[model samples]
Target: MSSSAHSDVAPIVVSDVVKRFDKVTALDHVSLSVLRGETFGLIGPNGSGKTTLIRMLLGLGRPTSGNISVLGRKMPSRQVASRIGYMTQSSALYNELSIRENLAFFGTLYGLRGRRLKERIAATLSLVELAARADSPIQTLSGGMRQRVSLGCALIHEPELIFLDEPTVGIDPELRLAFWEYFAQLNQRGVTLVVSTHHLDEAARCNRLGLLRFGRLLAADSPDALRARSGQQDFEQAFLYFAQQAETAEAGEPTPAAEKEA
Candidate 1:
């Protein structure tokens, strides 16, 4: 396809993807698409395969079956690596290096250099509100500060798509709110974000959410739509309703709502 045509495609497309570890299935025929410039949330409890899916999307792992395309290119493509950012759950910064140094290091890895690299470091620091402590060593910073640095490093390259794995975990409510504000600004600037979180309340913030359970995607839609479909105003209750429906269908039993409709 032409480059412009490729650009018109969805940022992420996963078709019937399955991931396995020996006999254990990490992802089971899960499929979803994330549109350009949208905030897509993967909502599920731990071990629901959110991290596994994110790893595949980042090209760090491969699905045992099916396919995934990221940024109009097949996953594990080096060509798309530089155009994406990933903020892992754990800190990936160097303990001995200063925040500024760490940003420069990650920026260089993304093929940035010279004046441009320096400019990005400054801009990233400002964006994360860590300019005042740019020279502080990673080990000297608190957990919250370290998380901010991690975010800065991920954004240093100004990628078109970003994957955040529980980015707000372990942070204070105020800091979590600040992080969401930053995310909103990124979305306004046309950056696509794929965030995985177990916090049900966070699901409402995304443009769309995929409810995952046991490595399967139960439903993909907007928060209001999911709630309306399940007839539950509470997001958590709606998720439970979908889970029950999936179980009913799997057991060859008509769901309560289906029986009602019939």
Candidate 2:
């Protein structure tokens, strides 16, 4: 084996990963690499295994087969998990805690303390543009602000890699742009980002994208490359084209019920 293959330079890597729930295969021999400081996106229809894949990558859920590595460390290994910051699609914050308190708590849990904890809390809130609202009740913040606060909480320990699952769901277009801007800024600062979202228009912002369906990886490449492969000028059309191709290939296949949103 090549020495670099086992080396830990990049943030996330997976090889032939598979996850199953009884007879249902949530991920089927999936493979991908998230390089250090790059923005990688996972795109797929609902129930196409995006969330399950992220769970496997985060080691929150185990893969039934194959391998996954995060931050140069093999996962499902609890010892290496602290290097990854994960934000689920849902707000995982304590609803009763103020934004500042929430960040403080998570920071402390991540082994931060004293000036370090306070410094991270202050810097992250500012990074997410939520410094002024640090004292606001988590329940009182608007959907967009709440999402930003959730993002800040994730960054409290400044993990070198971040996995964001639909982090922009409730955020408006303007703030969505701002969120990507933050991702760009973070990436520039050497933070690797792995994100999955249903937003096709926003998918263009990613440096690379992987398209999955029925727990299988159909395509993985840049937006431009995927568009070229689909022979479509527009990305939305390109996604639909791939979806149609997948359906046409399956025996008695039904067109994806969620394609309407794509």
Q: Rate the local accuracy (lDDT) of all candidates.
A: 0.89, 0.82
Give me the overall lDDT of model 1: 0.89
Residue 45, model 1: Cα distance from true site in angstroms: 0.4
Residues 1-262 of candidate 2 have per-residue lDDT tens digits of 1235333565677788779899998987777777778899998878999999888888887789898877666877776666679888998888888999999999888999999898998899889888888898899988888889889877889877899999988778999999999999999988888899988888899998888888877778888988888999887788888878767666455533222111
Q: Mark the 10 consecutive residues where model 2 has the least summed lDDT.
A: 253-262
Candidate 1 lowest-lDDT run of ten: 253-262
Best by TM-score: 1
State, as a TM-score between 0 and 1, how close model 1 is to the true structure.
0.94
